[model samples]
Target: MFAMLVRLYLTVAGLLLCSMLLVQQAFPYLFPDQYSQSARHEFSGELALLREHLRGVGIGELPERIAALNRSNPDRYSVLSPAMALRLPARVLAELAASGTASDHVSTEHHHVYVRLDHGDVVQISYDESDFPIRYIAYATVFAMVLVGLMIWLQPHWRDLERLRDAAARFGDGDLNARARLPGGSSIRQLCVYFNNMADQIGCLIQSQRDMVNAASHELRTPITRLEFGLANLGDTLDDRVARARVHALRCDVEELDLLVGELLTLGMLERSGPMPALERIDLSAFLRASTGVSAEELRIRSTHIEWELAPALKEVVVEPRSLGRAFSNLMRNALRYADGTIRVGAEAVEHGWQLVVEDDGVGIPPEDRLRVFEPFYRLDRSRDRATGGFGLGLSIVRQVIDRHGGEIHIESSPLGGARFVMRIPWHQPGEWRGRSRAPREEPAADAGHFEHSFHLQ
Candidate 1:
């Protein structure tokens, strides 16, 4: 707001100054007679007194008299020969001869006057301009007035713009109901109205989309259940082995569809505007252990090794266990799908918060695709198959959960030679617990197999 005001003030001041200068330059040319009259009127009294004094002095004594006047006055005085005076412009010389006094403005600041004495001598006077400070003060006063007026004019507009900007920001951040409310007399009231209307349309559109997804997911469950039941009964009745296998495959496809519907429902619910989940204080180490244990048991047949590196200083931290656990479980399952042999999970106390890291020693995601991986239904080119990638909603759900908890997540190249998922949860003040230890700790060993069990750094 201040910047806007400054810019406006400077622009107005510059244009005003330029216009004044332009008029000053053009006025003399556009109205020569009027300019001459004004200048002559301004110096008329001084010229009259000097002319009278010169008239009393003899022609030969005029130099000494004018020199005396020069010493006593700021205006320079001199005596000129009639022939020398004739060197002036014809019109000015004519005016001087006719009026006995004539003036010429040599510049905006300097003026010249000529007077004919009775002795046929010409007295030339030059003004030494010294009103610069006063002129500058006047210009400064004008600029100051302009600044004040600009502030008064811009204040309400700036306030209205700030309100509009904040409303747009909140709307972008998923506050679908956020709208700009401006006073009726606001200069940008029309803009605010348009913004509010846009917000309303967008809010309705998003609400409709969520409602449709939610309703559709619910509607799909009944048909999916019937398909599953029919497939199971058909598989039991089949006598041929190939037919049984085909029936089993059909059941698997129906289960996959059911899983997709369930994920859609979860994503839809997460997308809804509501209060955050209730937080609970839980032991960080135990939470990590339990979240990883379930995934480890499910993937035990793959012979994948799981390692935990929990900081000893990390004791109790507050979090919404259900949502956070879902996020962690999704990350673990994602790592399980891609990991070659080892998966590493770590939790450590960080300044003002805690950090959770999940890494797998598999093919790392491309740097270009890291951010897009968190978009719903967005999968890497290599993970397009059902066997390699689920419905591509896992990372999106994780991001939503982290956002709800006022945390953030990012992907990096893991030291374990694959993709790393890092989640940082800021300290929740409701059930805040600060670690007693603040000692410096070293980085965990890069090799996950080096730690057979959870390694706690004290």
Candidate 2:
């Protein structure tokens, strides 16, 4: 704000300087004669001295300078006294001289002039005094015009600065939409344009974080209530095996709740700010295989067959290790949850970059629900809920992490009649593929016909 004010002041000062230059150019024409009244009095005295000096030198035939000099009546120059007469050429002296001019003794008080010729004649001259009033009005008009012009030039700049200050104040008060209007297509427009873009990004992040928290809280409420009710019922049970079973179920519910809260907190913190992205070259194929192994093992323990493949063209990428790990983990978990037969993880090189596909031979999501699944805590099967157990933040967290890394994640139907999750993280360069292949995605027969949206319940 201080800086903006300084700029505004400088702009106004420049305008004022320009106005001053213009006024100086028009000053003489607007105010006609510039001579002072005192200068005119001095001119009269010099004329009298010149007349005396000319007469002493025996050239007294010269006419006075100030002959009753009305241009309208030039045929008769008004006469003044000999003492007040100013010298001029002998030709002008003959024109102004007249006979019997004693009655025309021009008034010295009015600075009139009279002259006599060698023929003993005299003539008088005087000036009209009315031009001074017109000159005074013209001077006042010109001064007022310059002052008004200066104000007119500066008004727009002042208004623009005030508007900018008001917008900044509103933004400080949390009105993120407040924007300074930049006048004229100049550097100021560039500044305002950039500031507005920054504000828009900030608003989106803030609103997204708020929505995430609200949805997470709402998703957690049901499992928490169920946990509380189950515990209350457990206190009244007497059977050992039944109580143990109920307690185990309660423990699972508690763990699910804890997981949901932890994931939400992670998403929130990621929204606020996270570690700066460090770009390091890494073998992406190895990274995906290693990360998916943990989930693959867990699924295998349940006798679930999974397939992992790494393409020869799949190369390394420049990315943050932890964020990439998180995104890969989410994709693996989502596949593990619904895979009935096989889960295939592989990468392929494309012109844009590398495309990583996490495909499973399970029922793909309905077309309408695919987009909604990317939202936090938005589960498609309401019956399974959190008790059957995933908090539904898996895809959302995946998207967030990928977005931060400037990559894109896409969802579509797989060739194996299952969901296909495609992630494209641009490879750093050509010929960087480096990782061993795991087994191909396989589908088991037991879960074939039983595949439905409520696979967790089954």
Listed in order, each prediction's TM-score against the native is 0.85, 0.46
lDDT of each residue in 302-373, candidate 1, tens digit only: 788888888788899888887788889889889988899889988876645677889999998987787789
lDDT of 2 by residue, 294-413 (tens): 454677665666566676655666666776787788887777777786788876655445566788888888877767887878887676564235777777888776655545666778
Report the backbone clash tally of model 1.
0
Model 1 pairs in collision: none
lDDT on C-alpha atoms for all candidate structures: 0.79, 0.59
Using TM-score, give the best candidate's number.
Answer: 1
